[model samples]
Each structure stands twice: as C-alpha cells, then as structure tokens.
Target: MMTIGMIVMLIASVVMVLASFLSKKTTTDREKSSPFECGFDPMNSSRLPFSIRFFMIAIIFLIFDVEIALILPMVMTMKSSNLMIWTSTSLFFIFILLAGLYHEWNQGALNWSA
Candidate 1:
C-alpha cells in the first residue's frame, strides 16, 4: 500500500510539472497583458472617486444579508422550540430590522435620487 502511494505521488508530481510547462504562454499580446476595466484606461491611477451613496447602499445590503442568515436558523429551530418564546423572539428580531429600515428611509440613506 505504501509503495503504491509513493508511485502515485511520483506520477502526480511529473504530470503537474509537465502540465505547468505546457500551459505557460510562449507569447504575450499587448491587449491581453493589460487589465480590462470597463473601457477605462488600465495605466491610469486606480484611485478613482467612488459614490458615498453607493457605498452606503452596499453596507445596508450586507447588513440585511447577515440578518437574513441569522433569521434562517431561527426558522429551523422553531419546530423544536416553545411556540410562545419562538414567536416573540422572531417578532422582536423582525421589528428591529423593520425599525432600522425605517430609520434609514427617514434619514434618506435609502433614497437613490439626490
């Protein structure tokens, strides 16, 4: 068994080396070598100005995504847990999420238009 394992390892190593050599590019194209950036020049400074509104919206999305992950487990546990306790806990969590969304709406963080 040990001899078979060693033979397999040796074969794998040789195949990987051959594959690596064969896969390497012999010639590089100027267009292919340059980074593609939605028609933007690749040589230019990459530190372009970003929209604060877009960033805020992304953060909001991530927060809600995480909240959804947390809520899914609660759903799975509902069958085994006490009905009254589970219902209250789920309601409280949902209420908090709604309150946060309302707050963001009121603060104009959710608004797309300036």
Candidate 2:
C-alpha cells in the first residue's frame, strides 16, 4: 500500500511538472483584453446596473424548489410514519413556505414593473 501510494504521488508530480512546462504563455495586448461586440468596441460600461426584483424572484424560486424537494421525500415516508406527527410536520412546513411567499409578495419582490 505504501509503494502504491508513492508510485501514484510520483506520477502526479511528473504530470504537474510536464503541464507547467507545456502550458501556453499569454502575451499582453491592449485589444486582446478589451471586450469585443460584433467587431466593434463596447461604447458603454460593461458593469451595468441590474434589477433587484429579478434576483429576488430567482431566490424565491430556489427556496420553493428546495421546499418541494423536501416535501416529496416526506410523502414517500408517510406510509411508515405516524399520521398525526406527519400531518403536523407537513402543515408546519407548508405554513412556513406560505409565510415566506407572503413576505416576498408584500415586499414587492414579485412585481416586474418599476
């Protein structure tokens, strides 16, 4: 096992040395660093302000998607689990999900228009 590990480490080091020597060297050029858009140089700033609403909506979607994934597994375990415990747990989870949704809705994160 020691011999095998040593051999693997030797091979990895050889590979790393070869990769470093064989890698392409980048030449510094002003035009190469500049952003190209349809054969024309960019007229405006590349870092433009984005809508916060879109980001909020995406986060909300991810939260709900994860909740759905959690809920699906709970459904599969329903047969083995106690009915009262399962019902209460599911209702609690659903209530939290609804509360989050309500909070986002009230915050105007769901609104598309400025």
Candidate 3:
C-alpha cells in the first residue's frame, strides 16, 4: 500500500515521462545543429590555436599533482620495518621532482613569455 505522497509522486513521475517523450526528437542537418548562443553566430573557428599557457599550467599541475598518488599507498599501508626503504623512496621521489624542476628551470620552461 502506497501512501498518498507516494501516489502523488508516481503521477508526477508519469507526467514527467510523458513530457520528456514529447520533447525528444531525432533530427539532422544544419538547421538542427548550428551554434545557438545569444542568437549570434560564433566568430572563431574550432581549429584556432589556444594559448600555450593553458598547456603549460596543465602539465605543471599534472607533474606536481601526481606525487599524491605516489605517497598515498605508503600512507595507507604503513608498511615499514626497515627505515631504509621509506627513506630511500622519499629521497628518490624528491630527487626526481627536483631534477625535473631543474631541467625546466634550465630550459626556461618556468619563465613567463619564454
């Protein structure tokens, strides 16, 4: 036995379903698929070159953000008997990070408008 609220919900759901069914229609061609923004045509082509800054920031974000994944397993498992393993892993991670940073610095990748 459904409560009154449940019955109302069912009716609303059925109405929504019918509305969606009426709204949906498959179409093809330019009239069906043109840019619709403020009733104005788009000025730029899709092939336009985007700013290098966008890609640079994205690569930097990917490099620094990945260390979280490297550290997470060790943090969760807490698997440490010999300090050397943890110490070496940590130093290795830092070494690689610094090396990459140094390379970027030398190559002027870190510089603005380079």
Task: Tell me the TM-score of each prediction against the true structure.
Answer: 0.67, 0.77, 0.57
Give the CA lDDT, 0 to 100, for residue 68 in model 2.
Answer: 91
Q: Which stretches of candidate 1 lie over 4 Å from their true place?
A: 22-31, 72-79, 102-108, 111-113
RMSD of 3: 6.1
CA lDDT of each candidate? 0.93, 0.89, 0.76
Q: How far is candidate 2 from the true structure (C-alpha RMSD, Å)?
A: 3.0
The TM-score ranking, best first, is 2, 1, 3
Give the least accurate 10-residue stretch of model 3, judged by summed lDDT.
Answer: 37-46
Model 2 alpha-carbon miss at residue 17, Å: 1.8
Q: How does model 3 fare in lDDT?
A: 0.76
Ranking by lDDT: 1, 2, 3
Candidate 2 lDDT by residue in tens digits, 28-108: 777676778775447666776898988998899898899899999999999999999999999999999999899888899
Candidate 1 C-alpha lDDT tens digits along 1-114: 999999999999999999999999999999899879997888899998998778888999999999999999999999999999999999999999999999988888888676
Best of the candidates, TM-score? 2
Clashes of each: 0, 0, 0
